[model samples]
Target: MSKANAHVVWHPTTVTKADRQRQNGHKSCILWFTGLSGAGKSTLANAVDQQLHERGLKSYVLDGDNIRHGLNRGLGFSTADRKENIRRIAEVAKLFVDAGVIVLTAFISPFREDRELARGLVEPDEFVEIYVKCPLEECERRDPKGLYRKARSGEIAEFTGITSPYEEPLSPELIVESGTQSVEESVQIVLRYLEERGIIPARR
Candidate 1:
């Protein structure tokens, strides 16, 4: 171990994750939402979080732009920076899972290696990859933040799905067709999956 690591030791929490899950009446997991820009990842993640909250379930959303303004403010859009950003978010999500909170992260990520790295941090069933599938043409047309326009006009560098590439998840836990489906329909798809997986109780 490195000198810095040798002194650091693992500390166990007195109140275990299972204890918190029992109290919260739901399982804790990470709902990782990956897609290109303008793919509605943040919108869907927030919608899911709201639904979980209304159901008295512990849940929170870690959005890309919001997080960039704070925890990852110093990072840029470079390839290395993007990887680091996802790494940090993954670590934070794992902590939330340990605290028995269902954490949803909305990010482009754009790399299979990075996504798999995030998955490896938790148990097999603890991480759910939700691919927000939308065509490049649709995303550019939508351009909610005008990012695609900027990228197309050469105002931005190394942007995913324009200058850089967005690697789609090969076999995601769920695939939300954001391009074709209504927002409410997409939200229901996610909720149904959670219920079927025993992460949340089914509605009466």
Candidate 2:
């Protein structure tokens, strides 16, 4: 790396919250949903984004599979690739937050260390980790994309909770039990959290 590139100074600009709020009409945050495969992270994230849209909130979802087809195309399932994947996604999410938009990220994020690193890249209170808690058996039963089946059949390598590991969040901001809870109920839980935190206004 060039010394000039490494030694660039950051002259902070005075961009007030009022200015951003006026442009986007709300505060920005990162809603990071983490879990194993087939744990309904993507499903819940999309549902929550739809609810936010209906309530006039500016939000977007950075889904794992979708990202793999584009920004993270070169990444694979290795630990190093997974860390890099989350790092890139965190940077993107930070940009959205700066633009005053709520960014929802749904990824396996199997390692707690990687998740914590992502959180460290953003400002304090800007990231909210939501743990989608579902048992491995239940996740296999649901198997919306049949990924679990492939993992079990030895067709896939380094699958979380089977061939690899899944590190549960020690103190997630929110936990949704997707195995027992209905999708509607899960969405309501997330919405209620956002409303309670004043991220979204309460209904009149």
Candidate 3:
């Protein structure tokens, strides 16, 4: 059992999430982009974030390597560490949502249970799980980070698609075929989804 931190007390904010959302002029959500290393998850996420920013919407992206270099430093690629890594990211994303900003996360996030844990932290409609689907061969061929080479050569262990596993989402909110669709098309598809779902104002 875990010991409770009695020194830590709950502090309620006068300005609630609803108030922040009202001020931002739109609802907040988490656009979770999960896929293989070179599956264009980061590319698609950044593209979508750019459009949202251009539309004057509050948005931010939590990238994998960036987070590891900072907030998630010292976390390894073991099963438990990976779970902890995801847990920490999810908590941060939840906080961003509370602050009325759409948080787009681009991570391998190969496990469905970890994604579900994040999803459970928010409202049903607030978590948009976007599966950036691409075949393993294509991802390896287009390995932007050279991660595939490292993983294939045994330089990196517990890699998602090579050494480890990648369990696809059973029913994700959106599935962008990175292997088939262009980045611009994927961005438009996500924007259209936000509009159709009334998360943001429709384009005039």
What is the lDDT of every predicted structure here?
Answer: 0.93, 0.88, 0.92
Give per-residue CA lDDT, model 3, range 1-204, as digits (tens): 223656657554479999999998889999999998899988899899999999999999999757989999999877899999999999999999999999999999999999999999999999999999999999999989898999999998778889889999999999999999999999999999999998888989
Model 2 regions lying over 4 Å from their true place: 1-18
lDDT ranking, high to low? 1, 3, 2
TM-score of each: 0.92, 0.89, 0.92
Off by over 4 Å in 1: 1-13
Better of 2 and 3 by lDDT: 3
Structure candidate 2, residue pairs in collision: none
Task: Give each model's clash number.
Answer: 0, 0, 0
Q: For residues 173-193, could you state the per-residue lDDT of candidate 1 as single tens digits?
A: 999999999889999999999
Candidate 2 on 23-142: residue-level lDDT in tens? 766778899999988899999999999988998889999996669899999888677888899999989998888878899999999888988987987787788999999999988888
The regions of model 3 sitting more than 4 angstroms off are 1-13
Return the TM-score for candidate 3, rounded to 2 decimals: 0.92
Question: Top lDDT: which candidate number?
Answer: 1
